[model samples]
Target: MERAEEGFGGGGILRQPPAVWATAGASVVAFMGIGLVDPILPSIARGLDATPSQVSLLFTSYFLITAVAMLVTGFVSSRIGGRRTLLAGLALVVVFAALAGTSDSVGQLVGFRAGWGLGNALFVSTSLAVIVGAAAGGSAAAILLYESALGLGMACGPLVGAVLGDASWRYPFFGTAALMAVGFLCIAVFLKDQPKPARKTSLLDPIRALSHGGLASAAAAAFFYNYAFFTVLAFTPFVLDMSPYRSGAVFFAWGVLLAVSSVLVAPRLQRRFGSLTVLGGSLVLLAADVVVLGYGSHTTAVVCTVLSGVFIGVNNTVFTELALGVSDAPRPVASAGYNFVRWFAAAAAPFFAPKIEEWSNVHMPFVVAGVAAALGALVVRVRRGSLVPAAVEPAPERVAPEGAEVLAG
Candidate 1:
């Protein structure tokens, strides 16, 4: 049998079935929703006459619902199957994105974004498993493909938002809706139903999966890491005080670096060192970078912001590998549980970063984010014993047929 790292049937990462490509394609559109509103944040604040904290609720609401909804993804997917679950998620995104475009107030927009988050939760949690199952290569290659889509979508989201949001804050929402509609059609046509688990998952299955010490450690560390990650994504646009086009350009660069490092750099680092070592070091570097971002001038801040993407990309791939491989649970269950813990940080950072600024100076938020990243590193250090090495495979053991087998023969 082929080694897991060598990939399935000796196929390369790029070679995959149509189902994998379709799932990955939709995943790109799904991830685009993450950064799609970034360039439009200031526009939304001004256009709706809202405070920065209120405007930041766009991220808060979306991720808050996503975090909570993760619990149900396995339950839903196991029963209805992957293809239907993906379609349901796409349908929700289409409806909510269009509704978000039509919102008259920050309140309405936040609510619509919350609805969008529910769809995002279902789609993202299921898409990873689908890609892994259908891809020609093994799990590592599938994850790289997913991360590449994340990078591309994140990169494109800002550019799209800048072009459309410059005219009006609402146009990006409508654009996302239309694009997801196309993604919906693609998945419908090209993706077949994924194989379901033998046992239907309960709503609490994800929660139970966290009982494994390694899974719990990975989730806890990722929770703090995501806090730092979203601080860059959801809060920095306001700190820069740039127009839609300029902000979009900067984040686009950041996203490009993120994509490249995730695909090209992370795997090499993993091979050279180990996943835990690489993750810990990357977290420390990210912490240092975020602190400098807090204290730096505009030029320094922009540079640090862009450079931080490299560390972020590495951390993302490593954490994902740990989450999926460290535990014995089903992939979907493990992913759901991992995301359920980490996405709360995605929600909390956006809401609290602006609030922190309101209560203190602007720099305090990044200071807090740096501390959070450091804590993530600390978690890795403390939990080192609990985490299983992701590359190690179990030894194969065979047993003879129970009833019909003869003695010694």
Candidate 2:
């Protein structure tokens, strides 16, 4: 599957090495656990005799920490190196997953989940740096690999959880832990550190990146985008509950389509239309999908669910890429900046969703998402932003694709 595609070897557009792709594979395996819980929340609640609220926090706490840590992980990865940081994060996943899955009490599960939060925080924060850092010289193939892993993780999460949950709710957690372990092993075997950059000794860096309008814009867009995503995700079920509509088949279709489109569908589209067009169109489609999903019932919901896969597939790669591409600050620092903004916004969103829902109804969250998405697109156009690859001019083709956009260069 190696592209063996040529790209810049120096000049900041150098090719990514094989080890980097292997590491992304490991990350995909480890990270896929994030979505597994969605399919079996009730199982967990019943198994533990916990309230629905407690079961719900499983998703909330993990994402809250993941988003918050994105800011710091970037900074930390640059200082420490991506491989080391990623390895440390993966190890923590194993420890925390075991603890949470095996816990005899609901409190123990919640506490261990918080521990999982720590590990995931490190993983989510560092992985992007590692991917972008791996692309230091620019291999678009590297970009594809990293994106594929993320997509793969997200796409398979629910289905994997569903399959494993059949055995037991705890079974899926154990399964994910085991997958993470294998990923750790692959990373151990394949990755090696490249020549290091001299660490900077300046306090002015922070003020510089945040001050960069591109960085701020990317972070803000990411925040609004995720806020909408999580808000809809957390509340969609409640909305479906309000109607006579059944959610199971719709969710399964959506989840399966999401997995398929990411792994099998988007690559061809990305190769053809290029990342920017795909990303821009995807964001537009996502908003449209949310609207249809919000207003419709049963069959329309299913159609919206399937189409939403395309939207997510296009974007799953792009936004994260933007977080890395928008700045030339020490990578970790830039990543930290983006993640801090993203997660902080995301963490606060759920707390505020009730107000949004109370102020309106289940439909309100989707309306908020649609507005954020539409406005974000407009902002990009006004600024002539380079956040998405299609929005910019061609760089050296080898580092990217033919007509692929250069980030800072």
Best by TM-score: 1
Off by over 4 Å in 2: 1-22, 45-54, 103-111, 124-142, 189-196, 200-207, 237-284, 318-332, 349-360, 381-390, 393-409
The CA lDDT of each predicted structure is 0.82, 0.60
Instruction: Write candidate 1's Cα lDDT for 36-58 as tens digits.
Output: 89888999999999998999999
Q: What is the lDDT of residue 99 in candidate 2?
A: 76
Clashes (backbone N, CA, C under 3 Å), per candidate, total 0, 12
TM-scores across all candidates? 0.89, 0.74
Q: What global local distance difference test value does model 2 have?
A: 0.60
Candidate 2 global TM-score = 0.74
lDDT of 1: 0.82
